[model samples]
Target chain A: MAQPLKFYFDFLNQSSRALYIFLEASKIPFEAIPISMLKGEHLTGEFRDKVNRFRKLPAITDHGYQLSENVAIFRHLAREKLVPEHWYPRRQLGRSRIDEYLAWQQTNMDVACTDYFQQKWLVPYLQKTRPAENAVNVAGKQLEHTLNDFEQLFLNSRKFMMGDNISFADLSAICEIDQPKSIGYNAFQNRNKLARWYEAVRDELGPYYKDVHGEFEAKLKQSGSSNQGVAQALKQ
Target chain B: MAQPLKFYFDFLNQSSRALYIFLEASKIPFEAIPISMLKGEHLTGEFRDKVNRFRKLPAITDHGYQLSENVAIFRHLAREKLVPEHWYPRRQLGRSRIDEYLAWQQTNMDVACTDYFQQKWLVPYLQKTRPAENAVNVAGKQLEHTLNDFEQLFLNSRKFMMGDNISFADLSAICEIDQPKSIGYNAFQNRNKLARWYEAVRDELGPYYKDVHGEFEAKLKQSGSSNQGVAQALKQ
Candidate 1:
């Protein structure tokens, strides 16, 4: 008998949450092995032997094959039709649009938003020191630029990045964008279309969203501290 | 009749060189349309409307399907055996390794090497004021770190990134690393193994490498400037 497909994830991570939501929504069977980065479990030697050079979480192993990186995993899963086919279209132009979004997001949304999360929550918590206002301002500016681009290019004409249906692109975006809200930015407050789209994504994700993201949100609130809380607590 | 596969390329680009070489070697017919970034051809309204939001070059159009980004195009073309089937293995581990290299390279080698190329060659030609030395130093450090990681992780044991055979991984690496050398860095001088691999890549590519890259190199030399030479020489 083949080993059950296993996903190594930490609920705290937005990337992992996106994949977890994806798998749950599609009703794919996989055992979840939680490797909490917050607890420094991911850096252990035993974990290192399993994952090798990657210090990041949210890896997947199936039939003894290990894979990392969210977009690649998302692509592999998307190929399995756990998500909408239009999420990674087979045609040239359609596929390129998806590819463009994936590539662009790494430097744009992923980097900027992650930086903001770290600055707003993680930095003050871990360092027990307030980050320079300029650092926070820089991250805020980057977030604004990315959000503006997302609105003008992606959310403007279509219901989703690719088209009318929800996609991994939308899921990926929502996960990162929502990070700010958890830390207190309220990204969807002023943007009506973005807010509507977020609701649609949450609706489509259904119970899967509740199961994975709900638990994580509970923990986040329980901590009563943003990344800063965790950081500051560690110092104490 | 279907429109012949049309490639918008500047041979100086690693991704374009890889694609052009692959197409030529495989005897897949493609029309090469040079879009010189140095001459600002890529920023033109005509190019923008046609290619859509992407500002980058090395885009391809096949029967009305337009695509940009090398990895996306490489994946599409590699499917047709312009390269090896194992270049993007369908299995989880094999595909992940390839995907890892592809994903890792974008922000790593691709961005770093491109910055180096621009600073070494393009900035002087294109920008009125040269970029600061510290900026150049930072870019150089990034390139070195990426190369070191490539050597330590991928190249240490395997003849290729996926092991024992050429794949798109080699193609992608060769293209970017070749950029610094073209601009007079002699990047492979101290790196004999990497040099040998590059030679092998060139040999594997055969006449196809010469036809596409050779033509572009000749044009670059003849013009002494970058895009100005290409634009002046090639009308359409």
Candidate 2:
């Protein structure tokens, strides 16, 4: 009997969703455990001390071997020969192409998305203060620039980020790119190629796509904001 | 004879220096080319239309093959089997351990250093504005938190970042961690574990250390400000 991989996830986080979709798609033996970032379970002693010290979400323990970071998890799975090589690519050039996107996105696209969320909700929801207009405007511009780069630099008419095949890079891109939607900003509004790529990924992920993002939409509808879980920090 | 690897570098950027030093240490056949950011060469048409579209430094050209981003470069070289296995590690687990650092640092340590530099120099040197007090304070706290994580989470008394032997992770960590020193911030001050790790990396890299970093020291000595060339944006 193979030991099941234990996945710790927070549904509110797109990083978590990306990994969850990836794990589910891999069809590997695993247990999915939801840890709420909104409720602040991530900071508790059990998670912080016993699991990930950095305390970010979407961590995995495969038969007592633990790993975090979406990129590392995908690579680890590939290295363990658990998932298809296409997800991470075994070829040097293919993996390098994916690596460039992985490295560039955290500092560029992800930061843009994070800043947008921070400006939109972090201040208003958490501090009970009006969102800084300048910060919101600045962050919005950054997000736009990142999206533009996504179109011009990576996507650029390719069926996927690394070309015809879908890798974890595409999975990561789709998840994070969907993040601004919590505040109702759809990156695909006017962009053609990006919109096409977004759809292709969704179609490929199948019903799991709806399961991951639709739940967020439902949460957004019910709660009126994705920032509420983090909002409690104001009292603390 | 094999074609030489073309390195496009700007001594102003420590990410460039890390790859530069690692390649030197690897004893790989390569040519080091400095593309001056000072003269606005990177933004020029030939450099952009033909080379890096993003116009960031630390790019490589090997036999007409083009690649950028420091991590991708290391992986490319390792895949080519040009460097020692220990630097990148052939084993999956070891590489995954290193990859975690590679992804984590860009967002944490690197951002902290960047923020501290911006606070200390960017606003005043070019913008003619007083440094933003809140921005500087925020950046300082972020740097402090990241440094704490570096010690408690990553290093944790290890000989190197990943394990006993030095890897590109150490080089990457050392280069970015040392950046603020150009502006006279010794992160090693008052820290024991990190200071020891800093010294260990310095001792290991040895003379090439002086060459890559000494240029920045010289630049700092001659210029007296860490953010001069970057300051030209204020004029624009």
Candidate 3:
């Protein structure tokens, strides 16, 4: 038997949740090794040595071979047929679009949404303190700009970013967008196409979303965090 | 005869320069289409529709096939043997490491460095006014952190990021580091290993760097920008 693939990530990370949903939806057998960034577990020397010395989470150790980066992991998993063939695109232009989305999202949507979550939810709820008001406002502005860009570039014409079929680009964007919703931002609620796409993603992921997101909600509730609206629904 | 490959970019961009240098060094036939971000060329509808409908640059059109993202372009070019075999590892693990570096750099080093360049140089220079002194100072601090991480994670152990061979990671990094140097920031000067590695990259590219960089520097000077030291050097 192949040594079990081990995924290392915190439950709260949007990228980690995206990967988690992918694995769960694919029905891949894997062991979860949670590395709590909040608890400083990733900073430990042992974890550093065993995993990437850089101490970045959302890494994976597959059959003793360690790999990092969501794009690489997604590509490996997709290559193994965990994702639909259309998701990874064999055509050069299609593949380039996927690469373009992935590259653009890292600094654009991902960073903006992550900053929003860190300020509005994580820092206040997890760290038990409020971030500076200006920081929060800046994050909100960034999030708005990112969503507008997404609306213009992605949701305008195609049913998905690439086409009618949902790809990793959709998955990546949906997970990050979900962050603000969990904090009661509701930015996507008014956007019809985006909202429809989110539902489709949730339906496809199904119980897997419950498993990854369910546990995350429980943690947030137990901490008595104010950002519990999304979590409360997940419990049911 | 094949229509020459059309490369679109702001020549001052490090990632763009890397591709330009690679194509030049390999003696690949291509036409340079400069996208002057300083003049808002990238945001224009004509450029957006042709290269990337999403309004991103550093894109390429080859045989009417349009593509974006530096990694995809690099891979495409490398597949054509414009890059050494070792630049993109063929074996599974080796290739994954390259992917890891490529992916991580986008979010970490690349973003950090670009942010610094924008805040420190571009915004003040192009806008023809200085930003807040505190903002520039903060950007400088963040850049220092990023450089320190680069030295620790990438430069410490291996001859290259992957070990014992020059790869695209080195090329990517050298281009970015060269930016600050162009503007009179000599972060690599005192760092012996980094300096040596940069020299190797410079030697590898040779006169190709001169042609692309020489034109880029001239354009910057012609723009009458007082903030760019690199442009000043080229003018002299």
Candidate 4:
């Protein structure tokens, strides 16, 4: 029998969540392995050599082939699995729209969310230091700007990013947007368009939704007190 | 009769340079339209509303279909043109490596190069102020670190980023590295492995290489103290 593909991720990461959900949705048999950023497991030389040299998450190794970068992972898997056109889009134009979303989000929502993540929660948890008021303010404003762009520039009133269809773009954006929830601020709270789109994404994801994101969120909640919380979660 | 695709780019942007070269190499018929960043052409209502909502490039329009982001543009073109498998591998693993290179560069060489571009040239050109010594030093160091990673982690003496045959990854990286040349620096000057690989990429691009890049290099040379030079080139 063929070896089950290995997925290495930490729930603290939005990209990892996106990939986790995508792999489960694709129905390809695989074992999901959580690498703890809290433990700095990803910083190990062995992980660098054997896994991703970039030492980033949402990466996979299948039958000895190692790959990293969430967008690449999504594209590779979508093409390889030959999933429905609605899922990833088969025609050149349709797929290009998905591509625009994936790439655009990098400097937009992803940057804002990560900055906000480090400021509002991760720094306090990991560094045991309070996030500076100025830093927090800056990050929050940046995130707001990004969220506005997400709704105005990309998500809009559409049920999905590529319209009516829940493609890889929808999965990727929702994962990034959900990052701000750690601060008890929901990006979808005021934006009806985005809120509706988020619900649609959750529905399309079905039962696989929680497994991909829930464990990570659970781990994040416990991470504040000690690194032990993350370590313990990894073991389970 | 079918309408030929429109390729929108500004040579000042490295990703645009990559797509310009790739489109030519793919043997697809296209009308290359240059958008002037210095003149704020990309910020205009018509460009933003019609071309790309994100208002970044290199974007494309085929008949009525519109798209933005170079990676998507390259992937879509490669698939639609049915280019040789070596240009864009048919198998998942082969394509994943290429994907890894393309995506890895985003956080790696791409970031560093863009920072360097802003510090060494763009800021100085647009702002009419000399780059801060401290800022330039920091940006240059970041670029050096990224180049080292590009060589050790990805390139490693391979004839191409995906090994041997050229792919979109090679085009993307070379275009980015070329940005430093506007400031009179060659990234490959000290790296033997990278220099050879760069030459191999240029060779593979064939006669099409100069047309995509040469015009941009020429434009950069004229943009220094005289916006008139750029205007003259545009008029031509």
Best by DockQ: 4
Q: Chain A only: TM-score of every candidate?
A: 0.86, 0.87, 0.85, 0.90
* lDDT per residue (tens digit) for residues B1-236 in model 3: 65458899888788898888777766678888888887788898888787777666688888777777788788677654455577777665666777777887887777777777676567767666654468767876777777777776667545566777767777788787766556556676457777766777777667877777787667656653565542443333
Residue pairs with colliding backbones in model 3 are none
Model 2: per-residue lDDT, tens digit, B106-191? 77888898778777654455455556768767887888888888887788677887777889888998888777666656687667
How would you encode candidate 3's per-residue C-alpha lDDT over A1-236 as one tens digit per residue? Answer: 55468889887788898898877766678888888887889889988888767687788888877778888888767654355666666564666677777887887888888898777666766655655578778998999888878776667555667776667777788788877766667677557877776787677657877777777666656654444532432232
lDDT for each residue of candidate 4 in A1-236, tens digit (9 for 90 to 100): 65458889988899988888877777777777889997899989988899888888877887777888888887777766645667777664677778777877876778899998777777766766665668878998998888887888776666777777788888888888778764556677678888888888988888787676677677775664465432332233
Better of 1 and 4 by TM-score: 4
Task: Please rank every candidate by DockQ, starting with the best.
Answer: 4, 2, 3, 1
The order by descending TM-score is 4, 2, 3, 1
lDDT of 1 by residue, A63-120 (tens): 6666777877777666654555655666535665677677777767888888887776
lDDT of 4: 0.77
Error of 3 at A141 (Å): 2.3
Model 4: per-residue Cα lDDT over B51-115, one tens digit each? 87767777888775778778778877876665667767765467878887877877677889999
User: What TM-score quantifies how close candidate 2 is to the native fold?
Assistant: 0.88
TM-score to true structure, per model: 0.85, 0.88, 0.87, 0.91
Q: Under CAPRI classification, how is model 3 graded?
A: medium
User: Candidate 4 has what TM-score?
Assistant: 0.91
Angstrom error of the Cα, residue B118, model 4: value is 1.3
Candidate DockQ scores, in order:
0.43, 0.61, 0.60, 0.63
